[model samples]
Target: MPTQPKVIFFDVNETLLDLQPVKESVANALNGRKELVPLWFTTLLQYSLVATVGDRYADFGDIGAATLRMVAEKNHITLSQEAAEAALKPIRSLPPHPEVPAALRRLQRAGFRLFTLTNGGSAALQDQIGHAGLEPYFENLLSVESIGKFKPHRDVYNWAADEVGASPKDCLLVAAHGWDVAGAAWAGMQTAFIARPGQALYPLAGPTTYTCEDLSSLADRLVD
Candidate 1:
């Protein structure tokens, strides 16, 4: 029989909430340069990692607004700071993906402690789950702000396990991002990769304990 995790750590962004709506926001902010949506997002994540490596800490939301301004400037799109902030505001209200609510409840019912660890800060994460009406399902919401680093950093994963009084080996990280799964696996935690559309597992990462099409699929494996 397979071992069950004592705790499950979820990733908040694309893993739980649908980011597709933000794509439209980005496209609009870029002056109809819809194609820059992906690039803008990539830049945001890249800069977040940069801060982590430089021994500096910045909230993901701050970095997001900054990066949006940078992306606009780079493309000579003439975006204003106000417009960028407005564009990013939609994140606060993003809905959970179709399968997320049921999947989370399933995991919760399985005798596992469920929590979130994200690059997003506490206030942002709380507001997000609250907006999606998901706060009830999660026992706690964690953020990387404490360590001043983002996900995929080994310390972040270990910190999460330590914070909740769980051993790394007994925790399973479920995320849509390959890099997050890779980091958790490297830290000796179990991992489930949610293959959300264009997202793919990293070829060089350690094998995932579960690879499913969505959160529901992974919950199915864990619940029954």
Candidate 2:
């Protein structure tokens, strides 16, 4: 039988919370130009990685606002810092995906130490979990900002293990993103890839310990 992890570290955005609200907010912010929503999000993720790769640290919210403004400029739109911040303000209150709450409860009941290790900033992460009513579901909410790097960086993964007081092998990272799964596995932790729609494992990485269509599917295996 495959060994189960004592600690299960989750990626917050997209993995746990539904980002459709952010899309809706951005649509309204752009005067119904929903087309810019995806572009703005992509730019946000891109710049986050850029900062990480450059060995610099910036809060997730700050990077998000900067990218929103950058994307707006690229498209010749006038997006002020206030407007960008307003658009992203919805992130802190995003609702959990339908399957997430139940699945998380199942994992906790099954005796797993559930924790959140997000690339999001400390204040934003606290607001997200509290607003979603998910604060009690996790033992601890961790952020990579403490380490000055982002996901896919080895430091974040190893640091999470240290915080949890577990060896990397004793923890499993659950995430919807390929890079996060790949990073955890490479960082000496086991991984479970939630194969969310339009997401696929990276071609360069080896297989993970588990791959499921959603949180419920993963819970079905992890929880009796």
> What TM-score, computed on C-alpha atoms, does each candidate reach?
0.97, 0.95
- Number of clashes recorded per candidate: 0, 0
The sequence of per-residue lDDT tens digits that candidate 1 reaches over residues 174-200 is: 999999999999999999999998898
- Residues forming the 10-long window of minimal summed lDDT in candidate 2: 25-34
Q: Which pairs clash in the backbone of model 2? A: none
Tens digit per residue, CA lDDT, model 2, 106-205: 8988899999999999999999999988887899999987888988889899999999899999999999999899999999999999987767899899
lDDT of 1: 0.91
Number of the top-ranking candidate, with TM-score as the measure: 1
Top candidate when judged by lDDT against the true structure: 1
Query: What overall lDDT goes with each candidate model?
Result: 0.91, 0.90
Task: Return the TM-score for candidate 2, rounded to 2 decimals.
Answer: 0.95
Model 1 Cα displacement at 58 (Å)?
A: 0.7
List ranges where model 1 is wrong by over 4 Å. Answer: none
lDDT (Cα, 0-100) at 64 in candidate 2: 88
